[model samples]
Target: MSPVLTYVLLVIVMLIWGLNVVALKLLVEAFAPVTMQAVRIFVAGVSLFIVLYFLKDLRWLNKKEWGYTLLATVFGVVGHHSFLALGLAQTSASNAALILGMLPLTTSVLAMIFLHDRMTWLRLLGICCGFIGVAFVVLQNNGGLGTISTGDLFILLAMASQAFSFILIKKVTATLSAGEMTAVMLLAGSVMLFAFSLWVEPHGLDTFSQGSWWIWLVFFASAIIATALGHVLFNMGINKIGAGQAAVFNNLVPFFALVSAFLFLGEPLLLSQIFGFIFIATGVLLGTGYVDEKLKRANLMVHSQSKPPVSIHDQIEAQGQHKAKSDSV
Candidate 1:
């Protein structure tokens, strides 16, 4: 595909992803927290499971991997979704997006602590810049000190859960296909959320509303579109464009989110947002090996349009090297 078209598709994916925030906030008005998550994840999980079953490649995980998978579901699905659902309910979606954007920094810190990942000076600098952006978000949301921060705190919890989950996922990704893992982990989250809602906060059981249709929109959009389709496309994009270009999409999420809020919710962001982007972009550049990879790719690309270069041997070697680099990191 042309560079223009690839970018266009990426932009569309980014927009759809940002809608997840606004959609959750809207659905929160109609459905109770646990109930909403139960339904959303269940639909998503079931849908993905069906697709995986048909594909014939989803594997039953090994015993040890299952343990990490369970932990991942606990944090990745259960804790992350619960905190985010409640957090979005109490706070504006704009705030949630800004806060959720801290995942990279959170994941980086967690990786260093738990996964023995190293942080180079450049990466640490990027992380510091990202934290400064997070500080702006916190200040904006809470209206400064001596104010309530339940919403901000909840988002932080979600970030922490995500950070924890990322480490667990790194451990498990070696053993499972992304689809197999997503199917199991999401179902686990749905089941737990189902039981929680069934017991404690089951108030909205028979709750039906005309506007609740948006909840399904959030479910399908999030589950099917964002989670399933988004991830599948991500894998495909990774193969086609290489991980570096695809990694760029991760940063697009926040930019699209802010723009969506500006258009839909009348959120007028301050100049501080530029700083946030700078931090996030730089952090992404440093953390994902993009900064270095770009220079490498540029040098390789300059080698030839005239020659039918880059045979299958070269491609395999490059991919193997990339995989080894990821494993070492």
Candidate 2:
């Protein structure tokens, strides 16, 4: 597919993910946070399972693959969403969105550390910008050097968990197709989340039964659109362009979330958040090598053309011919 089309799909995916934050906030008002996550995971996993089954895309995993998937389930599904659910319960969706905008930067750093991915100075600059941007939002909210809020901290933890999980995913996606890997991870995460919900929220499932039909609607949207479809597209995007370039798309999430929050939840977008978004987005753009890639390609072309074409075989033939001509002379 064209890069433009892929990007369009990415925008839709980010919008789904952004609105998902608002959906979570609303859902948790009537449902337990962990319970809501469990249901979302379950529904998303089951939905993927059905689709994979129909497409014959489901593959059996070996012990090693299962192990990696389990690890991913722990970090990506369990830890990431667990903190995110609790954090959203405490913080505003807009705050969470702005904080989460730093995901690409964190993920790039993790990739550099764990995956040994090369980092140019541009990427390094981007990483610094991202941290500064996030700090801007956090410090401003904390009243200039005051302690950060519990919810904000949790959101940061969620970002770290998900970022590290992406590093693990880089390794796993090497062997497993994105769809297969996502399905396995979601299944494991759903089971674990369900168990956690059972232990944490005694009346969790009962809340759903007591809630209105709109709750179910939101739940399904979160499950199918946000969790399942969103993840599928995310993995696909990663597979297409690579993790760094794909992460650049995350900068859109905060903007989308801000708008969604305003329209749906009546949340206000503050100046700090806007500034944070700009810094983080610019940082992510640099960190992802989006522009550097074009320059690199151009430089490669120039360097390749600058070298004279020479083949050892041709040289050898020329030498022989020259010797014969000299002997004739």
For model 2, the superposed segments whose C-alpha errors exceed 4 Å read: 142-145, 236-245, 304-329
TM-score of 2: 0.88
Across residues 166-265, which tens digit of lDDT does each residue of candidate 1 receive? 7898898876876778788888888998787787576755654544565666657777787666666566666667656876777777777777777877
| Model 1: ten consecutive residues of lowest lDDT | 139-148
lDDT (Cα atoms) of all candidates against the true structure: 0.74, 0.84
Cα distance off (Å), candidate 1, residue 101: 1.6
Point out where model 1 deviates above 4 Å: 1-8, 141-148, 209-215, 287-289, 292-329
Q: Could you give candidate 2's per-residue lDDT for residues 1-329 as a string of tens digits?
A: 77787888888999999999889889878788888888788889988887778768777888888887889889989998889988888888988898888877788788788878788999888888888788777766533545678888989999899888878887877778878788888888989998988988888888877778888899899999898878778877876777657777787899999899999999877777778888888888887666678689899999999998999999999999999999999
Cα lDDT for residue 206, candidate 1: 60
Task: Report the number of the highest-TM-score candidate.
Answer: 2
